[model samples]
Target: MGAAPSAGRRLGWKAGLSAGAALLIVGIAALARHRAGPPARCAPGMVALGPRCCGEGQRLDDAGRCAGAPSRCGAGLSAAPAGCVAPGATVRIAAGTLRLGPSDWEAQGVVEAREVFVPAFSLDAFEVTEQRYAACVAAGACAALPLRGEPGVPVTGVTLEESARYCAFAGGSLPSRNQLAFAAAGPSSRRYPWGDTGAVCRRVAFGLRAGPCGWGATGPELAGSRPDGAAVHADGRVFDLAGNVAEWAAPDRPGDGMSGTHGGSWTDEAASALRTWNRRLVPVSTRSPDLGFRCAYPP
Candidate 1:
């Protein structure tokens, strides 16, 4: 009011107000940044996920906290909520030199009968029964077969690929020819699974003078049907190594379109065919009524 403000003075007053408003806005932005703070830091061995950190193989829980994932089992084990566990009973066989086949086999150029060093491994004490294979099929891991035996009887009519699939589902692989020989003969290199003694009806289930197992067995018998047929190993005994059903074994050469069957089936009429060293080769896709298999695992 004292001589009315000059034009320049009014303009200066407006500029001062604008500068003060800009400074206030800058201060508010700074305060917001300070409240928000820097990005979250994760501890070692952990990674930041959103607003939280999770460890390896871990994820966020419903409470927004880090949690562990379900762990997977290794070979020869079954998965559970707690962890992995053995699928079934297994007999541990000590590593030893396998004197494969008989002298006659080598002489006739049937097999080399080489002395191979076999690493220690574990094997199922019994042949895979129909029930077991059926479970695998139900789980969508194995293929179906024309199963004829009872649930306790050894599974048959399974192709090599089907057998392998079942073995994998059981957390194992097929036994090698050398491994089967060692399990039957051991270090002494016995001629038969029990001993050098000949296979009789009382000791094995084979085609007898009358019929298979001295009975009219047209197909496979129950697993462990003959208790005397068991073979002693360093850790325990395995049944049906000489008869009941011929077991699928890994081929002498892998990927050769050929596979091997060890032991002998009830259809065999000759004791020589039941010897531990005796092996029969067939196409990988072959499926026989007397063909079955067992599984082997790491010791």
Candidate 2:
């Protein structure tokens, strides 16, 4: 005759089975999480709460979900799955204060370093390309660029008025001097778009060593050809803010008949000329091969 198992033995067996099942469930959950990868990062001015991205003034509700309507995007910007966007391949910049001058260099018209409140706006990621401008011209909104090159390259030799007209046709406007400086230097007021680093062929398309791109290149390469020259912001990247081509900004004073050209062009050889704060005044009607422009949208 065989003896029956004790009650304690049966209980112990049941406990072991339950423990094993629990351990298996935990392991499966960990593996699933690992396979799912990290959670999505929220855009600038938005906070990530679990699976929801809440705006600046939003709050969590009792159910642990984000509550409140998302703040509206600035004028000319529309909310998209990838944050705010403006017409003409632009990136949105949240409204904030920035130091708007160069602390190192002092020039005649250079305003001393001062805190300036910049409103929410959007700026083109790259200078206007010939392809985009050609569309405007074809639609009868803009005149044909005088110095045309590759379709992918920036269109140049447009007067300040011409640039403004193109911007308007593209659903934006010529960025003001302060707006240009804000986008170039950001809130940190970096000496260059990529930081304090000196300008080089890899970082800019200036006429230094050999030429643009340091390979005896004659003129500006394709727009955004110099990726290292991008001005990285929390929102996104703005390319060629310190090179590629000088950009025309709206005159600081209306009726002055003079506009500021900034960001030193491919023909600029001096590193000092490429400084974010470096600018020169020219007659609004003047146009040069190295001068181009991008647009800005209002808040």
Best by TM-score: 1
Query: After superposition, which runs of candidate 2 have C-alpha atoms over 4 Å from their true positions?
Result: 1-88, 105-111, 208-218
Q: List pairs with backbone clashes in candidate 1.
A: none
18-77 in candidate 2: lDDT tens per residue? 999999999999999987753333334555443233444555455433345446432333
lDDT values for all models: 0.72, 0.71
- Kindly list the per-residue Cα lDDT of model 1 for residues 152-215, writing each as its tens digit: 5578888888888898999899999889888988888887889887576656767732353443
RMSD list, candidates in order: 26.2, 15.0
